[model samples]
Target chain A: MNSFQLLNGLTFAALLFVVASGFTLVFGLLRIVNLSHGALYLLGGYIGYSTATMTGSFGLGMLAAMLGVAAVGLVLDQGLLRFVRGQELRQVLLSLGVALVLNDVALVIWGGDSFTVPTPELLFGAVPVLDTFYPKYRLFVLGMGVLVFVLLWLLLNHTRLGALIRAGVDDPEMVEASGVNIRRVFVLTFLLGCALAGLGGVMGGAFLALYPSADAEILVFSLAVVVIGGRGSLVGAAIGAVMVGLLNTMGQVWFPELAYFVIFGPMAALLAFRPLGLLGRAV
Target chain B: MLQVEDIQAYYGEAHIVQGASLTVNAGEVVALLGRNGMGKTTLIRAIMGMAPPQLRSGRVRWQGQDLVGLKPHEIAARRIAIVPQGRRLFPSLTVVEHLTMVKSARATEGWTVERVFGLFPRLAERKGHRGNQLSGGERQMLAIGRALMLDPELILMDEPSEGLAPAMVQRVEEIVLDLKRTGLAILMVEQNLYSALTTADRIYVLETGRMVMETTGAAANADEAPLRRHLGI
Candidate 1:
């Protein structure tokens, strides 16, 4: 309700958009419920933290996070998921195995104590927004969200790769039969999606801090956002993120006891009217 | 050139394509004709490496390279494209997007998006429309256009005239012949005898997953009785 709360909501939404888009796109194209996504997010933040600590550059850390997670995604897709093909159940279980393994690996590498990724010196301070001051890092996240939106728009609408992604989402075999190496497309999309999660994780870590339980929390938030947004739509993910982000922050502010109730209440109503979610096409 | 020699495929325990074999030379238009449930589509799927009936034994050779074990995209990369039965189009993609999404097998002198639009002006007019939004005829045209985008040397069209109006059937016939004129080889599966008679250089009949008959276009055209005996139409 208040400006401060509204700003917090928007900032939260921006990060959510970055994370949930990857989740939905991977699911849409491959029908793989990549449980490893949250682990990847956590991995990104931890790697980003270590990379920045070593390099003394937030940019390099971000880059390393994205590339590192992308590498992991490619390995998962090419080495294991490709062999499974069309068994959604097998894929889900495989991904769960990956998630648990990665979670353990992360725990071994980084301790259970929480750590916050430092905002770049350029975005270290606060900026005035309406009456109260807002963190510059939040504004930076908002800017990154806008950039991601535009980039995704151009990629999906104007690029051949985008067309392939959309087509693959509809019928992957048909795309392959069109003489396209849809295998490469699938792998690349998976990597790109994971990279997005990495970016979001680093950004989110700046605000939310990196801790043992953060991955589970983000995974839950991302799942809720994708379910509300509907799968197979970039615009839907963005809108869903904003709705969930606002509801989460507002619920805590107004009705602390029933925050879960506040979030699910609207989601349930929306699903009752449109079972396919906001923008999801039928499977 | 393509050759399917002694290929046997199965759907679990149910034998589908039993010793099916056929060949297509360059600039040839071959029609695969059979009654419904004769495994005409299963043969096509086998050739394309899509397994419903897994290829248990076969040598699918294209230009001396065995394609039995190659993936769908690899087969496609060898300049083979399938306009699959029911048009299997991506319902979400726009007409223009369909033509742009493919990776052309031919680097140069290939079918471009503009060329496809010129071939089917109706598709050009509705370039912005999604695949599901287009009419039956338009959907068929878009499917063909999508295949053309790959610039394949050989195109496999499965029941291209299926579910089409009489007028649309005529259009598809003309389009098939027009594509043939470009010196591209075509293997078309058609129930429409007229379209087959019109476009095919040779016709092969499949009876329950086996190649039952093969006849030249000229001989088949001259004597309808022999072809009619196979088709029963």
Candidate 2:
């Protein structure tokens, strides 16, 4: 791939990392497949677009989108996920139902037309990179993705709270017996994961047009990222997203006829060799 | 000090521990001895507030406060730690991480990671090894070290010596004695009568979910017939 394509691939991978990281965290800690995560991402983009349009402030729109989706995540965890804990099938079914309802709700509110949040004026311009013009907003998204990764790594490895979370990821029962309030950890994880998805929605919406069915489309890609990265592994998710992002981007560039098959073929092959994905450990 | 007053615990509708009561004083080591399925674990579960052994009716008081409805984490925060049966270590975590995770609850000036390493030098050597990679004895040491990291005022050890080799059992006994010298109270449940009597200051014999006899370790060990009959040894 050319330097421009490589940079673009990296930028796309960064967004995928942010979105998939949360999915991995929830899956790793709670062992719950939160299907509504896609809906949260879609809702966040719509919220960001409307908020930015109303307030004429992109930053505020992103903030409002994050907080709103985080609140929604809290409600999902406390009001819905709590009741369906320990039953994987039930959680999937319930979350899928919620996702469908959320999609319809968004459609009713935002209508059928696609919407876009114009990139911030400062970041709207393009920067010269290796003789190719790269959108400044995409670079900003890449920077934010790296910042979030480092922050999350520090939070999970350095702090006492992070220790508790890591311990929960390893053995939740042991965490509970250690006198750490595991329920609070669960709620915090849920909110944090959803917040990341919301951020992804906003950034992604800015990059790609947002419509009512955007949730389903993003969900498929995010799920593919999670599967290739392995369940519950943040580093794995990041690595997997970069690999998949490169493959998907390069496939379209080099072999457009077999691009879709090329993207999923590696996932199928990886699963065949390691059912837990590239970095997943057997639970 | 701890007092379990007529605690009736059940697994669903099946009552496992019916009115079982016992006590452990500060710096003392007590043993809850019984045959399999005779409610020894049920009593421990009741005290720890673990599910299945629902505290149907009873009061578990430690330091003069009721522990009947407290969650397991609350019970641990209140200075009670349990080395559950089978040494339930986090299979993915290393020994060092296990100790570090629960270090928040460690008693000030007591049972630091250094101290735990001192107690179980084997764990120190295998600090980076995951739980599943360790032998049974090593896993047991890691479990003990994990509990010690909490710096609990009172520890409930369920079958710590179970399934360990004789050498490991001796090492565990020495550690128990050392913990007792440091003024940590312990309630141990054991199938190994000889090892239990060696470490425990007092013994509570259970039969079919009821406390049949309570005696000092010396007295119980002196009367081998009663010990053997109750334990089915």
Best by lDDT: 1
The docking quality of candidate 1, as DockQ, is: 0.71
What TM-score does structure 1 among the candidates reach? 0.94
- What digit string (tens of lDDT, one per residue) describes model 2 on residues B86-184? 998887567787887787534457678888888778888998887889999999888888887777999899999999999989988898888899989
Query: TM-score: which candidate is best?
Result: 1
Tens-digit lDDT string for candidate 2 (A183-258)? 9998898899999988888888898878988888777777888899888888888888888779878988999999
A15-120: candidate 1 lDDT, tens digit per residue: 9899988998898888888888888899899888889878888899899999999998888888888888889999989988988888888889998888888767
Per-residue CA lDDT of model 1 for B51-155, tens digit only, reads 676888989999999998888989988888999999987877788778777743233467887788889999989989988898999999989888887778899
For candidate 2, give the lDDT of residue B58. 80
Off by over 4 Å in 2: A1-4, A128-132, A250-260, B5-15, B36-38, B91-96, B105-141, B163-165, B207-213
Top-DockQ candidate index: 1
Clash-forming residue pairs, model 2:
none
